[model samples]
Target: MPPKGKQATKGQKQIQEENQSTLKFYMYIIFGINAAYLVLQYIFFYDSFTALYIILFLWAVGVNFGSYKFMSSMASKGIDLNMEAGMAEHAKDVILVTCIVQSISLISNYFWLLWLLVPGRAFYLLWVNILAPWIFAEAPEVDEKKQKKMERKMRRH
Candidate 1:
């Protein structure tokens, strides 16, 4: 059998790879939806420059910048984007901004039917923003003292 240290390293690498693949899959879906929304906006609403269009465009730009900031903050913190907790937190922050902008854009454009598009995207965000990250979070390493304290607390409850 391999040394314990080697085995642990191997397991960590496998977890990293799995996390990376999952992140890539979700990113593709998110970007794809964004692209589709942009194209639809252009096709259906492109016309003489209007204040509403300008506002929507500005909001889109803000959302893009916000996403960049989110990624940069994670990098600055030395947080791996593939790590579940960090990824989920970032996703939640970005998704809230995205949802707000999308709602405003839909209302301004009077695309009532476009509201139908929201639930699926919201569901996707909810899953990645909460469920996936929680599931993938590493179990906290507990010292003997902490374990004893936790056991005592459990018994008291």
Candidate 2:
């Protein structure tokens, strides 16, 4: 390492701070919404396992969002080490959401599946709408190049 650079510029620092704050704001909104939903589930469903699952979902959401928010905040303050952990939490959140939905659908006698069709469509939504695109950020670009390379190599071979 050549003594490291001078780090982020002022504008970059400001943008980073803004991003962190926004992330935290989003996290708070998510946490509050989940919390309220849990409360309502308890009130309406009266402590059933569904309500319990809802509560667990809320906790998982909070952990995931809060972890990312905290990581962004740390990065704004010039700490980059925690960002990986935050990303891991976000990935975990995605998996947890799908797992919870699938498990609940199965355990609830396929009632939620009726909301979809057949069963386990929630996994499709979670994976396609969220995880697949997000997890492989470089997949699209890599795929185009890979296809071209494969075509050229096949022609040569």
Candidate 3:
């Protein structure tokens, strides 16, 4: 058999690949929604092509591309790089922070801003990029015995 360390590393690599694929899948869905919104806006509200709308669209595209690049680079980094040990908790913090920031932006609309200061597209990108690393990080490996036990229990249910 291959060396034990090599096997563990291979498993971790596989997990990272899976995580990256999941992130990419979600990114594509987000991009599709954004594109659909832009098309619908152009069709139903031709007059809505104001400076704010243009800026928002451009910004959304930039952020989406940037986030994709960032995630790809992060995924390709050495597996032992300085990932937060407590990634699950960090993921929760990221979500909470994104929500708070978005809330502030939304509340700012009361000041009569012509368009939303923080468009949903921007927040979506932020959320994806911020959470991706943690979501993809390899979890501590379970023992084979425990795994088989769990599998047997699952099969019984």
Top TM-score prediction, candidate number: 3
Name the TM-score of candidate 3.
Answer: 0.44
Question: How well does candidate 2 score on lDDT at residue 29?
Answer: 54
* lDDT, each prediction: 0.60, 0.55, 0.53
Q: Estimate each model's TM-score.
A: 0.41, 0.37, 0.44
For 1-157, candidate 1 gives per-residue lDDT tens digits of: 5565543333555655654554556456446556766676677766744676557656655664566557555545545555555664556456545645564564466543354454666688799989899999999898999999999999999
Error of 3 at 15 (Å): 2.3
lDDT comparing candidate 2 with the true structure: 0.55
Error of 2 at 85 (Å): 16
Separately for all candidates shown, the number of backbone clashes (residues 3 or more apart, or on different chains) is 0, 0, 0
CA deviation > 4 Å runs, candidate 3 = 1-10, 78-157
lDDT tens digits, residues 35-108, model 3?
67567667866775678656655654565555555555556763322245533333323333333332333234
- The best candidate in terms of lDDT: 1
Task: Indicate the TM-score of model 2.
Answer: 0.37
Which 10 successive residues of model 3 have the least lDDT summed? 106-115
Q: Cα deviation of 157 in candidate 3 (Å)?
A: 81
lDDT for model 3? 0.53
Q: Root-mean-square deviation of each candidate, in angstroms?
A: 11.4, 12.3, 16.9
